[model samples]
Target: MPTIIFVQQDGSEQRVHADVGQSVMQVAVNNQVPGILGDCGGSCSCATCHGYVEKDWAAHMPAAESYENDMLTCAMDVTDASRLTCQIIVTPELDGLVVRLPALQT
Candidate 1:
C-alpha cells in the first residue's frame, strides 16, 4: 500500500494508506479525509474531487485524459497542478503522494 497525504485548505493534513489500483478519491473517502467530497463516486463527470498534486509528485501521475481535462474546466481555482482525485489511480510509484485541496470544491 502507498501512503497519500491530503493537505486541506486550512493546511491540515490527513495521511492515509491507499491500496494499489484504488483511486485517490476512493482512499480519501474511505478514510473520511476532509476536503475530498468525491461527489461523483470516482466518475469523471464531476469536478468535486479536485485537488492540486504536489509539484514533485505531479510528474509521477499520468497526464489527464481528454474527458478529465474537460471536466476540470468546470473546477474552481484551477491550476497547472490541478487534477481530479478520481482520475488519479494509486500505484506503487505514487507512494508518499501529496495532494493539496483547493479553498473550495466545485
Candidate 2:
C-alpha cells in the first residue's frame, strides 16, 4: 500500500493508506475524505475529484489524458498542478504522494 497525503485549501491534511492499483479518488472516497467527491466513481466521467499535485510531486505522475483535460474545464481553481484524482493510480513509487484539495469543485 502507498500513503497519500491530502492537503485541504485551509492547510489541514489527512494521510491515507491506499491500496495499490486503486485510484486516488477511490482512496479518498473510501476514507470519507472531504474535497474529493468522486461523484463519477472513478470512471473519469466527472471532475468532482479535482486536486492539485504538489509541484515537487507532479513529475512523479503521468501526464493527464486528453479526456481528463477536457473534463478539467468543468472544475474550479484549475492550474498547472491540477489533476483529476481518478486518473492517478496508486503505486509503490507514489508512496507519500501529496495532493492539495482545491477551494472548490465543479
Candidate 3:
C-alpha cells in the first residue's frame, strides 16, 4: 500500500493508506471524501475528479495523456498541475503523494 495525502480546499488533510492498483479517485470516493465527486467513475472522460498535484510532486507523475489533457481542459481552474484523480494510478512509488482538491468539481 501507498500513502496518499489529500489536501482539501480548506487546508484539511486526509492521509489514507491506499491499495497500489486502485486509482486515486477510487481511494477518495471509497473513503467518502467530499471534494472528489468522481461522477464519471474512473473514466478519463470526466473532469469531476479534477485536482492539482502538489507542485513538487508533479514531476513524479507520468505526462498527461491526450484524453486526460482534453478532459482537464474542461475542468474548473485547470492549471499546469491539474490532473484528473481517476487517471492517476496509485503505486508504492507514489507514497506520500499530495493531491490538492479544487474549489468545486461538477
- Give the poorly placed runs of model 3, Cα more than 4 Å off: none
Off by over 4 Å in 1: none
What is the Cα-based TM-score of model 3? 0.95
Cα lDDT tens digits for candidate 1, 1-106 = 7999999888889989999999999999999988889898998898999999999998898899999999999999999999999999999999999999999886
lDDT of every predicted structure (CA atoms)? 0.92, 0.93, 0.90
Give a tens-digit lDDT track for model 3, residues 51-77: 899889877879889989988878899
Candidate number that wins on TM-score, 1 or 3: 1
TM-score of candidate 2 against the unseen true structure: 0.96
Q: On a 0 to 1 TM-score scale, where does candidate 1 land against the true structure? A: 0.96
RMSD of each: 0.8, 0.7, 0.9
Candidate 2 C-alpha lDDT tens digits along 1-106: 7999999989999999999999999999999989899998988888999999989988888999999999999999899999999999998989999999998777
Question: Who is ahead in lDDT, 1 or 3?
Answer: 1
Q: Candidate 2 vs candidate 3: which has greater lDDT?
A: 2
- Order the candidate numbers by TM-score, best to worst: 2, 1, 3
